[model samples]
Target: MTHPDDDDELIQELALAGQGIALVKMEGRVFLRFEGVVDEAGLHVPYALVPAQGVLAKPSKWRKLEREARAALIAERANERARRELDEHVRAFVRELAEECEDAGLAPMDFLHTLADLQTSEPAGAIFDRIRQRLGHAVERQREEQHAERTRQSINLAEYPASFDVARRLPRRFIALLGPTNSGKTHKAMEALAKAASGVYLAPLRLLALENYERLLEVERHGKPLAVSLVTGEERRLAEGATHVASTVEMLDTRTAVDVAVIDEIQMLADRDRGAAWTAAVCGAPARTVYLVGAPEARRAIEALAERLECPLEVHVLKRKGPLAMEPGPVRKVKNLRPGDALIAFSRRDVLMWRDMVAEMGHSVATVYGNLSPEVRRAQAQRFRDGSADIVVGTDAIAMGLNMPIQRIVMTASIKFNGVEEEEIPAALARQIAGRAGRYGIHEEGLVAGYDADTHEVMRSLLKEKPVPLNTSGFAVAPTLEHLHRIAAVTGETALAKLLKRFIHNIDVPDGFFYPRITEDQNERAEWLDTLPLTVAEKFTLSLVPVTTRVASLQSAWEHWAMSLAKKKVTRLRTDDYVLHHMTLQEVEDICRLYSAYAWLGYRLPEYFPDVTLAQDMSREASSRVDSMLQDQNASARRRRPRR
Candidate 1:
């Protein structure tokens, strides 16, 4: 066969001959165009041609060139086919390897780079064999780690004593008051506590505690005044020779024995963030007779707990004293509103707007919400109760244990954005808010109204349905100093927050119980505390600070107070010069929270935070000012409205 280089040389020779070339063929069939130069005449010119037969011979250069081209085409096609097959095989192997790694809980990404390199190199089969061997070891290691985790969880659960074990030491009798809202469950429980010679009242909210404390102080025992003390996170008021105490659930003084103990809002045992306190109080309160007051939904769980404790249990199912019915249509505007009407709003801005709107309609208005201090909420409730305010605009904070003689409840919206998402009010919550409408002796019937058609329908449906029963409760294993030390030693972690997280992860809860996870805010605060120069125990204590971290100013104040406390310095608070008139409601609320945090720390470390009395007075003043401001704003709005 003629080489390609020879064909190139022949083409060059033909180009230099000056004859016009028509076509060139590998088989030597060439066509040539020829012309002769003449004076106004054309002449015949000789044309050179290459015969096809001569070139077609076996030793011809044209035949060799054709043969070489055919061989190269075949080789290229075969190479392409081989490369496709190799890619297909590698892809199949990778898929199988990925599945195996995932099934064993091993990360396939760790070996992805190595697998990619092997795919492009020769002798890939050997590398794949080595990868398979390593994968087997990885699977074994993963299994071992899972087993260790399970074992650790079991050990953690076994370290703590169950409620039954703790209750076995005491001769306690339990009485549960199960009913829906407006059922007078809390009232009955309070009556029992009042009759007892020495007792305690545990309320879910500080407002409720304060209410009961004042009630007890006014009660006459054997023609003499009863001595009652108030204990909450923010303030404490001790009466001389006091044998009865009213306290928030977190301040239940579980170490002291009492004749009777009343725990209100027992249904809150299902709350994710604060349920642990309720559980602890129920399981550990040192009382001869305990009264559990809440909705009927908590009956099953409380029964189970009572059975476990081997206590004498009696259940009283209370019925509502007055009728509760939903209004037929929506209440559109302030013109349709009336005296003794409470408008419920989800946000502070909404509450303020509604209050102003109602006041412009010539009705006096008071406000209540979660951000307001306990004292503020109480003062607002008092105004509504005393008929000093013609109407009240509030939030779900009223639904918990506040006693207001509201004849009707008008919900502004059926849905509220609960921090994470917008959700319709649950049946239980709806019932609680609606139940606030009618007072037993005051209003013969309670009416629930909605602002819109959708809200009206939701309210009607919720009032008709029963609350879902509580099937599970959350519990956490209490971490002792020993437990913390052990977890740090095992996990090689020096940070208290990290150690607490690890310990919680390894705790084994019962079948119907779960461990509450730390909230995002809590985790953020804990991370910030981890940077301080404090011991692990101190950091852990600071992480558990009861101050609300959602407010930026309050969080900053708390961190500074905590740092001072950690340094063992007597922190002096400047509250005398706090100008409540110049501050917004939110700022006043933040200051109230700061005061509460200081008081809470004082209860734990009195030497470090000795300004509890001052903090309490400042908090009370801040709360009173907020209430007064709302009232003043309402009067101003009423005056500004155009006269008819």
Candidate 2:
């Protein structure tokens, strides 16, 4: 298959075609020349990850697609990683040779750049090697030995506790309330927090933080109301003379000593992206008594943390207050859905679509998903709780946030798209979602099943399976600004991206227990922010902001926020007039999150992003509008339902 016209005949004979590729029959079978090239076989250029639209007549059947193009893409991804490694090597040279450059009369011009300075295919370290050779091998060897010693001492993690003076001063005690879902362990920890004279609750989610914050403010103890502060990336409500505080885990105030601190979701120490927050809270919470509440899977991780921190720990394993049991069979149809039911789907589209089908069957529906704001999810959950909505359809967002009187959970499918491809859901996630059934006071026994026979069997099998135990690696640790600044002082480097790379590669960790983790998103954000004229601290701060870059709108807003901050301008926050006029659910959700990012940035850079209150107000309004739209959709669906 060489010429364009002959390619048609080849595709017709093979019953498969892709963009710009040639194939030849070697044996009985043929393979794709995915790499587009002017090869002898007359292959053209390869299309991207997706094949050409009209070329793929039967995509599922054309499984053999591998020639040079696919291999080239794999090489490109590998090269992308190599590029970062090359950047790191350049950073090491910058750190290890700053003094050598000064001695050789080139320090002034040697503020070495990142890999972005690479103009050709030449390696970034070649110039540094040339400098090293010019400085004489004998002098360079002695200097290298001395520099290695300094780096080892400067980047040691053995003294990590000393970084948190408030925590180091206290004789802390850990109380780990480890158990499965519906075990009431978290409730017990919250009870202790409520009873403390002064305390803080560190929740994993903003919704959970807000819910507990409101509870602390509303509940009176000893005939007097307790003033409480609400702090999270999304919003903040500072109470007057607050004795108690409820904050998202990342907002934990380790500097302020408290009588007690409650850290929810102890098992999240296994999380890749946010686990560092949990580690920081556990190691740095300046409280006399700290409650670590989460699944039993986290018990070992907590034990490792307590041992390393030299804190006393008491372990308590609790039993479920209400037993969970699988249903005998599937519901068979949407009509079989019960009033106190939570139907679980994996995607926002699936959840909304399923909600419509349920509503069209004459059931009142409320929807919750990751894209929806916490306010919206809370309101939808309220509807489900108050019997205003007969059933709730949601993604995994509903699994952990709210406490509903759900008697049964129905799984829509056993498979979900995990950002890449459709794969069978993990047993642990399915169990966590299913465990939402039968609250202690709400229902006697929790029942779980699937919407169909196959799904029901999958659920039944998953319930009996056990979750894997978490590793006892001290915990995932991320760098604080203090650590970064210390690195900068010692290494004479100013680039934030280089500082992070140094943290991962040059840091000396003892016992390999505390593995350093910097998420891919953070590194990517740092690289992009490096293009602007910003301080290392500013770049680091922007990198950590809770911005979901997957959404193009959110990504643009974050970039705009960073650019505005770089220009030293007050980024005014206002609702788009068109958004107010024609607010689609997707648009409102995006705008609501945009306001959240604004509010979050305001707290960090108050002078620049100074619209905290306005952003919060706009966020609430957007959420309320979304809630109203949900009700309107459900009402419309019910009206369209065939009345029996």
Give per-residue CA lDDT, model 1, range 298-333, as digits (tens): 898888767655678899999998999888899987
Candidate 2 lDDT (Cα, whole model)? 0.78
State TM-scores per candidate. Answer: 0.75, 0.78
| Candidate number with greatest lDDT | 2
Q: Alpha carbon lDDT of residue 343, candidate 2?
A: 95
Kindly report which residue stretches of model 1 are placed more than 4 angstroms away from their true locations once superposed: 1-166, 473-492, 510-517, 565-570
The TM-score measured for candidate 1 stands at 0.75
Instruction: Give the per-residue lDDT digits (tens) of candidate 2, residues 1-644.
Output: 13334435545544434433334333232333232222111212111111111122222233344333334432343233443453445445555655555574444222333222322222234545655665556455545444445555687776766678999999899999988789989889988999899999999999999899888877797788888999887677788888899999999998999999999988888887889889889889999999999887788888888998999999999988888998889998999998999999998889889999999999999898988888899999999999999999999887776888889999999998876699988787887889899878979999999999999999898888887788987577898888788777776778888788878776788877776789999999999999999999899999988878999988998999899889998888765533653868888888888888888888889999888898888988988898999899889988889878
Worst 10 residues of 2 by lDDT: 45-54
